[model samples]
Target: MGAQHDKMEVGDLKQEANRASPVNIIVSPDGMMYDYLNLPGRVIINEEVGASGESLSTRKPVKIEKLYEYVSALRSNSFKFLLREYEELCEISPQCPQTVGLSEINQSKNRYGNIVPFDHSRVRLKPMMGKESDYINANFIPGYKNARAYIASQAPLPMTVNDHWRMIWQQRICIIVMITGLVERGRRKCELYWPKPGFPIKYGLVEVTNIKEEVRLDYLVRILRVKIGREKSPKSRHPILIHCSAGVGRTGTYVAIDRLIQEIQAKHRNVDIFNTVYDIRKSRSMMVQTVRQYMFIYDFHLDAWQIEGDPEGFKNRKMVERQKELDSKYKELTSKDDLMVEQKATYDLYELFLMAACCCCPFLFDKN
Candidate 1:
């Protein structure tokens, strides 16, 4: 009798499963019932009803494997969408250059080492050897007919030798207005002067410590005004060249700000500054590195609220203040005279090392 009853119970369960929507049921190996429902492609599994005329006492554990499978499917769909979108974007706006980087360099081992030839076709590759003079003397290449170039000295180094690389690589621009000890050294050693002949390098050598909200704003304003003015004319000037050291992080931020300002002026729309930066980085590799720098940009846009205020009142005042305070302390630490001197000496050594290394291995200088 008990065996008959068990058979009847199993038969009823099977009937129940068959009667329910094919999409909404899963019978586990342990005979635990799971009622699966599709919630916009995401699966929600509920426990089976109990024999006691009550819901199941135990909660239905999530099927992690099934969840991952569903997520993977969604991601695949998203990637396809993005690919289609990218293709359409390329077709519609061929003028917008795709981001390129140093990783594109060949990695095959040679007798000396991995040798990478400089590719001038790359949007981001800047020749290390060629001065502005060299570019002017050379005949215009097909695509580079409207090309221009500029160079800026890197910031002062940190207290230690290891820190020097960080300072030179991470510092944004060497502004003439606020000269760092490092900039001064670069000017002396490399004969690096502002506005080198045949090039219109902006001469505003700001110290590493002085790259504050005001400094960024000032630089952005200057670049945008120049770009806007030139764009107005029929015989407009060449594309403005902006660089720092490694052509990432700070350089990316500056470029992002420039592009944002341009877009704002053109569209008359207030853009999410953080989102703009994020988008730029997504399109390029290692564009912005530090979370601190990212927060600085966010704070800068937020502080603008004191004067103009957020029209929508969406700015997070508390978070902005916290970041500003942290950045302020960083600036204070960097501005000490002894530290500044140390930083300068370190940067000088790095520049010498870089120049020497590049000479020995020409491929090291190849940015493409």
Candidate 2:
């Protein structure tokens, strides 16, 4: 009776193990990978095909050898799941002290009441003679090595223009990367804190002179007396100030890209973006606010890899087309849909990614 019971127990354990097994992955004939997620609907093979109606090879070029692993990780079935996991972690993570930012004296300085910097990471400006408070709605977001590498701040309000310039002057900030315009969708997103080109504006004791303005297809560059560079110079030692409307979403995205660029340049591989954004969120709440922004980091990193791989500028026609496609995708993500219905949109993207993962190399997704 004991021997029979042991055999039955072993059989039950095997059944349980089978139930816990991962989904079956298969490789398509066209070199694409696919993950059979066992969804009720039929598998819709949405892929980019050539003129001959054959699926284009999804393999990475030898030039981007280092990115092979990274690319595989992005295309894995688990990638989206990991993104979702990290996002949930961000919600439940231990928060730093925000008492100073929430205090009555500093309440009016914040652009959005809820989006305040933690006391430990907040930037402190020199207290002016008349103004007793040395507070700014900004936090010191760390980079690869520097703890105070970047100052993530909210867009300046009309009332806080002087405080903005004061923080800039006190920090000796060289570059100001403004990610939003003065207005968006008939709403005032940020205040014009700088003077017009060829004009000098004095905010508090600091004078900002706009020397030149260069307009491009998508963005405009303004040459200001406050120089922009990350050299070892004393003037450039201060953290580079980056701000958007609320300062978390776009600022965090840009900061992540900056950190990844540095990492890729130094090592060319082993880049962990999940952990990168995780650390950023630890410093400030909702840094990379949405999954769309998180996906944009992947897109930007892929583009960077391509550009870096082919230093000779000998990209094929397919590469150029891919670049254009990424650019179009960037524009779409920046639209109002990203702000509204983001949860739905992100899940929709996850579904598409899972489909693509089914068509990719299974070895890349292998845990071993």
Candidate 3:
């Protein structure tokens, strides 16, 4: 009788906690429950709840009206919220071993011994010149929609330059986003892999030429023309190579910000920094490596919301009109096809349009 009484007390406490909890628990038909911190959204299939229960992966429009309200509330305690989230992420983030990257045969291929890619997700180069081993210190990172949208790699060392180009050529990568200098603070962070503008250099059989470079106040954009033997590099939605000295710090931060920007533009309402970092770290450990970097992601999103969330700020602008047109078209396309694949394609196209705008008109975007 005493044991039964104790069980009843335990059940009562759990019920009380659930009632008092601020989070909303969403249970799908399959009995899978998803919890969000005060996030409210319309119920859908629920099998495909997105970063903040937005259901971006589905064709049907997921209600995100409450996300703006949540963001406003978050803004009131942004720093404190992010700090607590970061601490929690550090404790729960999963990681894998760098077995192959640290193997004796491939040790020299890594720029830093401690900063190696997970064996499971590392990019594998084709065996060349009769060499049996294929290795590079890089991992495939997922983008907002694409699973293999970006490659996070350590900056190339002197010996591994050829391998870097080989991976790029093999992967048919169109974009290369480097976030480090050749040297920093009296330390060599990366080796110069690209030729001078208008000059061509051959790394192994791959010929790379920097066709043009545009220098801005804060960032420089380079257009590269690459060729491999008889075939010229074709443009496609291939994985972009993004590297920093350690590959996880600035690389991760840049990728996170890029993904979040796409999310904000796509949904136009919600932003989930904690899950973004958590998801990226699962792919490549230690992504957004520092607390300051994590905070920067939040800062960037808040700044972006100021512009993107303001309908009046972009009134009478072509970008806004285009956005509205896309929204209408996206709804039409989703209604007709009713397939996830089609929905994904439309989402990717929308994200590409926003990225192109940011690239073409840096003045329009606040680079802070």
- Provide the overall lDDT of each model, using Cα atoms, as 2-decimal numbers: 0.28, 0.58, 0.60
Candidate 1 residues 34-128, lDDT tens each? Answer: 11111123322233433334442211221222222222221232122212222222222212232221232322111112111123322222222
Per-prediction tally of clashes: 8, 8, 0
lDDT of 2: 0.58
User: Which of candidates 1 and 3 reaches a greater lDDT?
Assistant: 3
In the predicted model 3, the residue pairs found to clash are: none
lDDT comparing candidate 1 with the true structure:
0.28
lDDT of 1 at 47: 36
Best by lDDT: 3
TM-score-superior candidate, 2 or 3: 2
Please provide TM-scores, in order, for all candidate models, with all chains considered together.
0.31, 0.66, 0.65
Query: Which regions of candidate 1 are displaced past 4 Å?
Result: 1-235, 265-268, 282-284, 310-368
Error of 2 at 160 (Å): 0.6
